[model samples]
Target: MLARGQNVPTIEQAADFVERRRPEVATLLISRSVLLGSADNFLKSFPGGTLYAVKANPHPEVLACLGASEIAGFDVASIEEAESVRTVCSSKPLHYSHPVKATASIRDAYKIGIRHYVVDSEVELDKILACVSRPLSIAVRLKTPEKSGTYDFNTKFGLHPAESVPLIKRIIDAKVEWGLTFHVGSQCKHPKAFSAAIHVCHSVIENLGKMPGYLNVGGGFPVAYGQERSDLTAYFVEIKAACSRMPRVPLLCEPGRALVAESGTLVVQVIGRADDRVFLSDGVFGSFGEVNYSKIQMTPYHLTRASAVPSLAESEFRVFGPTCDSFDELDQRLLLPATIKEGDWLIFPMMGAYSNALASRFNGFRLPSVELID
Candidate 1:
């Protein structure tokens, strides 16, 4: 049987919950202990202050959990996100990390006591300058090499390191505290990717002839998904070794997926099956946005039959969402037991990061309700 109010319920308990409740709609089970464990991993792995990227999983419970952890603050893209974080934990520092911003957002963020902002161009810097007269802590994002991440963040936002020299100088001249920052990209599996970006920042600092207030490596810290377990220690070791040559300065990181991805699970029921195609209660439009839109690999999943019987036989099957659109099918096929049928449950792990945060109510399918199992 499932144990409610427990901090670390076993997988058997979760399977039992799915078999007993038989929820018609999808269910999201969250574990506070797992969230804390991820937070602790991040706090111990990085050699600098950490900021949770609010865009990854901005659930109120997630925000509150990290707010209470050793995390320094949050990295928000819009004023709404800043306001949301403020509501949960008012005192945590907020950084406007998005490169482009509306003048109104800048003004509202400033009003809400957000002093840190990221800019990649003079136009954005001008916008920030026009919005506030007070000294601001600014991070100039440098366009660096895209070494090895699932998503490339360099194309849309960052300035060439050479071009950032003048911008940083201008920020310093504006009597604002300045810093250098870059994103290695999302799900960065390579440890040297960070070292490479830091090298570029080092060059930029060298050109400036003086160290800035801080060097934010930005968030690309990876977490294990599917069959691979990433070594967080390797990434940390590489970053520490690379930064050894740089001038002594404060360091910061904005970890979104790594801090919250392992804390949640998505439970969906098999609604229908045709030949080798199986339809689920939730799809790309709902909790599987990353799988379709971002092309991120599916999280690890297991099966739980409603009858509580186990199957050892296995076969490959195509998965689809309940949406009317034919494109709702998952990009990759899943291997499941040949006995898998309608009413059986599919429990996906490591879904705490971007699953529900990006869900949409398409086809009149509501987002999954979150249940704290721990």
Candidate 2:
């Protein structure tokens, strides 16, 4: 049986379960039960708004759940991703929000009925104009500098606010229908970062002397990794306060990580142990750090044939992966119950986002199989 607490998966039980079920097969089990709760909570929090950021985790089950929960659209960066969203949840609006635009990508997006586009430079704007033939709606991404303790999205895309004005004028002069958008950064830990971006949006609208139909406050909401993060309600309150000072416009947000992380776990078997150091069957390159570049914290517990309970003391242990590469270490030292042993099962939580999406078959380690648990 699965344990009840968030950090209480026993290692011995996990190993025995894996051995009994499929000795040769290892898998990454996704807890849909946890994800549905998170998705429903987020939807209730951001009522009457569209969320279209799909850069986090695009597992088809996750997408189908989000679609059922009434997500308004999907913000996709590539053809493959757009197709993935389409495969799972069709009929929602799609935003081709990748700042850098390629000619072929634009043509494909147009053919796929993606009318909303985000452009950062005049060159990209020209590219969009050259290719798009339908009634298109565009969002001019504003280049905002990265602040300390917040994400910096300016390096990749967006025009300077001053530069944005002329772009708006040019688009208006050309009679191209467009809107305004800006991404504060990724994994933003502060609500002020979003508020500041909204303030900037207000300024842009005031200067342009026209209100676009939409304002995309691009994705940057954070997910809890080792600690509870800032409350998103407070962030939305700040956003509402900021918008109160500006002209009324439809608001949209693209949140990827906050929606999917913490709803999944990475399970690995302890293949070998030597001098208190345990090596896992999977490696970092196999299923960790495609989006968030950090090692997962291993929570080890006793899982197999149990004996009388021992004193609840802790010990520090190092964990390694089966890869031959020296850098494939999972964790150097993690605090866990002192009774861990070889052939144990170790689980790492909050790995639902970028880990699986960016995994590779390096070192001939087969990709961890995925199963959804509702």
Candidate 3:
């Protein structure tokens, strides 16, 4: 709603724009200050080189903002993300961080000037070797504890310390720069989880008898969501202490959610309501895709009434998305004013990470429009 090239100075102005326009489509308000501040804080707090994980939120504006920040570079999971980043900041460094990459993607990333690649197994390394020859740095993915974070990634990627020694040796045998990397998992709660993964990396380094060029503590930085919150400083302190024992090498990190989750606020309107179920303009198929899991809760919404109405007590409501599928409902219940009805707007904050990035254009529904705010 504000005219093109015009930006709202605050969330209140953004809400006012929504109220005036009353657009039925969901609108995402991105705070430029929050985005830049998050990047600045992470860069200052993190021990070494920082690479924004492009997979978290690759919105053009998001990429543009981080590209302008002090971030050292970006870690892209696929050729598409690499291309997207290149389009924004052609000179910024790019790391092909995904453990498993398609043959063509490896070739494409190499062509895109990406020299660093991560692998969990020798086969993936071979794939990279077959695609690109020299002037490369390979990071072996070390498997960390599965229960360390809300979402476990050990089952999908990463190699055990015992299994990683030989693989790292092969990376060294190739005469290319070798390093160790591990993900504690996404939305990691326990700061010690990072320390545990670092310990595993140190063990692998000792077993190989070779100092890695760098130690990549892949992103799992937590953010406050619902009642789940942890001090970001605690994570940094734990990581710095653990790395103190390891061989001195450049430290690297790929932070996704921790860098961008708090910069976004999603405003959706109520379309329909039943006894206790309320349908929203957007749902799991849209920006709320992550809400299908009970663990992911977007609560404490600010209601913007379409018309003046008396306030009412809050009550739990089953939230549903604007999709034909029966499974397009959120597993978590939201507490809204009992007088909540159709045409009311519910604004949910801290949604800048995977919301629109994970949305699908199912049933001809478009993704939420993005509005940048200062």
Model 2 error, position 91 (Å) = 1.2
Tens digits of per-residue lDDT, candidate 3, 74-147, equal 99988889888888899889998889988988888888799999999889988988899799999999889557
**How would you encode candidate 1's per-residue C-alpha lDDT over 1-374 as one tens digit per residue?**
12222222435556767867878788878788888987897798789999999999988888898899999999999888888898889878999999999999889989999999999999999999999867689999987687578788887899888899999999988899999999998888789999999999999988889789999999988776664544589889998999998888889999999888778778898999999999999998888888765565554345555455556777788999999998888998887777778888877777788888889999899788888776
Clashes of 2: 6
Which pairs clash in the backbone of model 3? Answer: none
- TM-score versus the correct structure, for each prediction: 0.94, 0.88, 0.93
Best by lDDT: 1
Q: What is the lDDT, from 0 to 100, of the residue 186 in candidate 1?
A: 87
Clash count list over all predictions: 0, 6, 0
Q: Rate the local accuracy (lDDT) of all candidates.
A: 0.84, 0.70, 0.83
Flag regions of model 3 displaced more than 4 Å.
1-11, 227-230, 306-312
Model 2 gets an lDDT of: 0.70
lDDT of 2 by residue, 1-374 (tens): 22334523323333434545543334556666666667667767762465756767777887887777767888899977888988988788888888787799999988888988888778988998999985888888986555523446676677778889988887777677778888777777677776788788788888878988788887776765654432578777777787888888888888887677767666676687777676777767776544224433334343332432322666776767678887777544766557666556656666677767777788788877776644
Give the C-alpha miss distance for residue 355 in model 3, angstroms: 0.2
